[model samples]
Target chain A: MLFEVTADPLHPQPLIDHVRKDESGAVAVFLGVVRDNSRGRRVLHLEYDAYPEMATSVMRGIAEDAMERWPLTDVAIQHRTGRLEIGETSLLIAVSSPHRAEAFAACHHLVDRFKESVPIWKKEVWEGGEVWIEGEPVERS
Target chain B: MKARVRLFARLADLAGTRETEVELGEGLSAADAFRLLCQRFPELADHSDSVMYAVNAEYVNSDHSLRDGDELALIPPVSGGDRAV
Candidate 1:
């Protein structure tokens, strides 16, 4: 299991390779990239900041939850913090399992839950000004 | 009790400091601490509805109990990028 909050770009291949095993014939990976547009505004770049202490703990908890919920061989999650340009890789998740089905499901669950629970904030640097974009809280009305 | 209250992004800017030691009354819950925080920084009042609290590095509900020397963080509604794993 691997969980990290880093400022550097996520190299998915390395993470994927690390979890690859001959017993697990399939490996699934997901990469979230910075896009050029958001909510009809043209975004120039995104600045990601995390409450590191909490962010890592939440991420690790997500990983542990994924393991308990799935029969996966290995799981790795990496998220980049700091300023990133459009098209940059901001987050990566890799999962390996004996079969492809569990790998895909675990990978999706990890990312989805991470977004919903992690304390990460992204600032949208538009042409005019930058606005902080906070992630949704765990509790919602 | 002394708890390190951490603020992130816009909340940090509004609070004027990244982290502060919040002195709380005995047997204070996370919600109680939050009320005091709002009182100290009135700017946070506007966001209290959407804010979430975390204790000991995990997201917790309003009723989560706070102990002495616990680390608490205030998380605001995320608007921009998607969640990463």
Candidate 2:
């Protein structure tokens, strides 16, 4: 139930609080933000688009995968879709586990897999142009 | 048969719309439906190789058979990244 997709700006503190637990000794957090530059271009902002229902379902699958692979106590992942300015947070993943190792490992695994499998897209807008970053390549046309 | 097709990211931009309804033969495959889409939006034909198909929100092979009223999505490579940009 923690996985979600939103069009609004993302905040990480709530996720941190949600994943916090007395039984877990360690928590790992990952925050993804839009930066000021990309491929030597001054990035003005980014626009993210998503198939909301599938994206959320995919995120939930990632959290479930992480729980199955590690001794994770809880996992929460939230990603924002829509235009965002430089340094704005776009994604957040929080994981709690009995040990730091499990927490860290699960967090890393979730992010990587989510990037590869989730149905989300990002467009990098620069001063003069914009382009979609690499995903599954659009080669046929 | 009829299918509700969804386009995302670059695909949506190419088509100038997010969703469309495509008519398919009774036994048409997902790939055939996609081909029909490409025919409607020629620009999408160029990305045929890089695209993926999802039936009912679950990723599936292009050869998967289609059913009437199924919701299909044309997915461009997802751009989930950890980098700041």
- What is every candidate's C-alpha DockQ against the true complex, given to 2 decimals? 0.51, 0.58
lDDT of 2 by residue, A1-141 (tens): 398899877788899889988889998999998888876788899899999899888888888878888888899999999998888888899999999999999988888888888888999998778898756553331
Model 1 per-residue lDDT at A74:
87
Report per-prediction Cα RMSD to one decimal: 2.3, 2.5
Candidate 1 residue lDDT tens string, B1-85: 6999998889888989888888978788888888899888989888877888888877788888888999988888753237432
**lDDT for each residue of candidate 2 in B1-85, tens digit (9 for 90 to 100):** 6899999888999999999998978788888998999888999998877888889998888888999899999998988754432
Write candidate 1's Cα lDDT for A1-141 as tens digits: 777889877898899888887788789998889988888899999998787767777778888888799888888888888999989988888999999999999988887787777777888899989888766555643
Fnat computed for model 1: 0.54
Angstrom error at residue B69, model 1: 1.3
By summed lDDT, the worst window of 10 consecutive residues in model 2 chain A runs over A132-141
Off by over 4 Å in 1: B78-85
Name the DockQ score for candidate 1.
Answer: 0.51
CAPRI class assigned to model 2: medium
